[model samples]
Target: LVALPHANAQTDPLPSWNEGAAKKSITDFVARVTTQGGTDFVPVPERIATFDNDGTLWTEQPFYFQLAFAFDRVKATAPRHPEWKTTQPFKALLDNDMKGLAAAGEKGLLQIVAVTHAGMTTEEFARTVLDWTSTARHPRFHRPYTELVYQPMLELLTYLRANGFKTFVVSGGGVEFMRPWMEKVYGIPPEQVVGSSGVVKFQIGASGKPELMKLPKIEFVDDGSGKPVGINRFIGRRPIFAFGNSDGDLQMLQWTAAGEGARFAGLVHHTDAEREYAYDRSSKFGKLDKAWDEAVKRGWLVVDMKQDWKTVFPFEK
Candidate 1:
């Protein structure tokens, strides 16, 4: 490893990361995982790090990526289910019904994604994500979904690479869905991203087009305790460092913490509602209950959005 920052002085890494507590956390964790005598230290190349994307890296105020998938899904499916126009949750999402969306609850949102994502090919699903993000913007932020990512977290990703850690996004999000834009938004290349994925097969249509289809079946979901499962599947090693926000990430943090020797786990508590959506322990989306308790008990770092971060988003207010 070279002495130069942002790279091992050997493998050049994300250079755009800024200096901050977030950055420190990242560096300190990487040091623990890679140093020779470090308790959490493993080797250089084997230093695998995992992160949950939605609430952990960005905002999930509205919901997860699948929720956004559902929104577009409902619109596409509405033509078939005409009655959805008058239905409760469908009706809300259809007519730009923010109020109805609020009323739909978790079950309503899942209903929307199930119908939209299950049967499509992986390629078609990717296309849908690209197309939807092109037009969709956050309602309150009024910014493109890609633009809603947290700047500090982005910087943290870069900073980790400066050390010896190989950062991987082990998110609950649809793998194909996030692959397209995450590179541009987070500076994390597509290959480094590990998220939930439906089965995909390469197929050439009779029309002579390359189409990757999303199977009507779910192959895997990279959420909850599944985070560690995904890490094992994709990166093939237990990570030394893990970052997450909600209870859904409990298993991920637990798995990371349970590792032998030096281990670091951090949670980004959404405490700044004025700047971003702030709800924990009781929020409908991205709730932080069990993880919050565990974070305290285990002496894991719990970041209060209002206290730790000097800034949130990239854009200046």
Candidate 2:
């Protein structure tokens, strides 16, 4: 990894990325789009790039951060409910027992998210996420979860932005869920994050602050078809590059690489089982079955996690 120049009017674009096939592809694409001499240059500077948040940027092993947040929320709130001590998943979470909750599966996780996430205002929820992310440490890694983010990916984000690429996190995870701390963690601003979101309505509080309420119903679940839809609605432009780790991102990658002119699409495979939990076609969190097949079929770069990545997380200790 190289020390990159800050984003400025004349920063030599995409300096953070390495000098390899990946770097060459990215550099060439940007050059084609911006350089006057390059053939088939896109006149407009609309290089939208989408990335999946979980498993792509950070370690998503034990489970997703949002899920862990929801579980913690249940633990914090379960005492107030009292009856939760007798409930199935709620009781499991209240006891700080994730294995029991796992026995209940994804439905159980959703229940935890709904009860803890649905009633609060979106702003409150966002603040809560920020608060939690700041303090919470990953269980196995024993580092702040934010610190567990892939260093190479961070480099790639900077590289893209340097090349005049507008990056968006098009994730299956919640939008209000991620936008809170992503700016600090990923250098991605809140507006650029497009993800699954609960319906948010503006409400004027007694303090006269305009607050956004988080409705129980989901306004969007930005996975599968929703990823493309979110991109169309939020970006209004087809992406030139897409990066993802799972089958959930197949459509997003497809849409970007299929577009006209030079495009880049790649998948990050989790192969380092010792450093991080390895799961691909068989695993639960970010399953890679369809994407693995499609990546090969489409000639998309399949990044072998251990080989392509020089480092996994940002924590030095």
Candidate 3:
């Protein structure tokens, strides 16, 4: 078995994290919440911790991994739809015209996602995502996407769980897309993940087997304002702890902070271009402008990746 990174001899719960204010805050918060008879002591079931996936748990630089998956899907399915060869966005994609694809805008992206992600059974879609994730590698790292997960965040998740905190991934990524691999990668189960989703219908297939067919229409987005709504609708509890890395996750942090008692809201600020990436405010993807300001204003923890992390990825030696 591959030895997963863990705390050093059980002495430190977050060994991958460096000795800093960010690390100290986490440990202090955990201690306060878990200390029996303490004023800040929280019940086990009340320790809900929600984390954003893309830039928080893993890297989402250049672009989101899910969008990359969509692009690959476009290529794989292009052969079946001959008309895609001449279509605007499809033609742009076929020609590897990044500018042209960008010109197509959000409308074009939604069209691509609708075609690629829908019109298949949930089981079929799950298999497709699993197969792609198994072989697909990040462009810069040349490592499997799953291997790109942040080691410090993994340690943080484990640390929180060890302290009776129930961790959940509340991301803007598709729920079905994340469900198939979350347990293996993040140790979070399918039901614990809340994300954007498209419409799906339950019906009998040709073999008389019941199946959930994915539809092109979007059901609910789990970003920005939709985040709190999704949490309320699905998770049924206000998260006491929340971690994210972008403006898109602002509402989640806000919602978590609004909850009563011992709330911890943290943001992972990417500041290590040498080791990984250095981006914020201006980044088109995972932009951290408003949220950064809010974090400062609210006295929320803003973890500087370069300073707070002793290691970046688990594969690092």
Candidate 4:
């Protein structure tokens, strides 16, 4: 048997990150929190880092992955329910009409989610998510969606964990949807994830077995102001560091930065159109409008994707 190689001593913790102010700020903040007897030093147990999953941790371009999954489910379930052929949103989804889908709006999306995500037990949903995540690929990248996660962000998560900081994903995506694969992908376990979710009921099924059935009704919408509400409700502690990429995350950033002691907030600006899709202020999905102003005004680290990252995904590295 051959001996395994050890980690390179000269390897940078954030190898995908280029030498820049944004990278420096992250390293500096981590240093401050871990340094003993320093004014900015924080206890290991108190070092909670929350990250918005969509654009902040991975890609949310074109559409949210959950939406994509819902669309695929609509197609798969169409054979069972022929009435979907005549339905408004379902017809739009079947016809591949983006405009019609948009016109259907939140109501249409909720319908899709209800039909696709509900009725099944949480375990069933977990299995479905696991199978899909293993097979599903990003339309643009032509790689498994899990493989599309940003390398720099992955490095940051690893770096934080190494420094005894606990990392948690606070996304607007479905909590159950994220929980299945987050531990494998982000090194953050299921208990540490907080996200929007539908209601669940514990009941005996027709098979005479007890199960937690997912319901269509919304239990919570964890975005904007709701982010802080979720953080307080779930984590029970204000995060020392918050990372996000949209106006939806402004309140979370504000909440984290407003806390006493040295706080760090970062925004991942999608500026590299060549390596990744870029749209800000006017884009429908993951709009970075009001938050950009706040980042500048508050002197928060705004990471320029083009300038700050040497590589985008792990494949590039």
TM-score list, all predictions: 0.83, 0.89, 0.97, 0.96
Residue range with the least summed lDDT across 10 consecutive positions in model 1: 9-18
**Residues 1-317, model 2: lDDT tens digits:** 66445444245443333446765665676677777667756655567889998999987887888887887777666668999999988888777676898798878877777887787787678778888887877898877778888887887898778767788899999888888778988899989999997777788977898877787776788998788888999989998889999989998988888898878888888988876777898887899999889989988888777655656666642
Model 4 C-alpha lDDT per residue in residues 128-240, reported as the tens digit of each score = 88888888788999988888799999999999999999999999999999999999999999999999999999999899999999998889999999999999999999999
Once superposed on the true structure, which residue ranges of model 1 sit more than 4 Å away at CA?
1-26, 34-41, 76-89, 96-107, 118-120, 201-204, 208-210
| 1-317 per-residue lDDT for model 1 (tens digits) | 44755345334232333345654665676666667776656777766778889887888886665577678768876888999878877899899978878788867766676677766666566777888888887878887778777777776777677676688898988777789888877777889899877666678876898877666556888888788888888888888888999998999999988988778899999988888878998987788999999998998888777766666888742
Q: Tell me the tens digit of each residue's lDDT in model 3 across 1-317.
A: 65545534467878888888999999999999999999999999999999999999999988999999999999988889999889989999989999999999999999989988999999999999999999888999998898999999998999999889899999999999999999999999999999999999999999999999999999999999999999999889999999999998999999999888899999999999998999999998999999999999999999999999999999995
The TM-score-based order of candidates, best leading, equals 3, 4, 2, 1
Q: By summed lDDT, which 10 consecutive residues of candidate 2 come out lowest?
A: 8-17
Candidate 2 has an lDDT of 0.80
Clashing pairs in 4: none
Per-model CA lDDT versus the true structure: 0.78, 0.80, 0.94, 0.92
RMSD of each: 4.9, 3.8, 3.3, 3.4
| Clashes per candidate, residues 3 or more apart or on different chains | 11, 0, 0, 0
Let me know the TM-score candidate 4 reaches against the reference structure: 0.96
Candidate 3 or 4, higher TM-score? 3
Instruction: Show pairs that collide, candidate 2.
Output: none
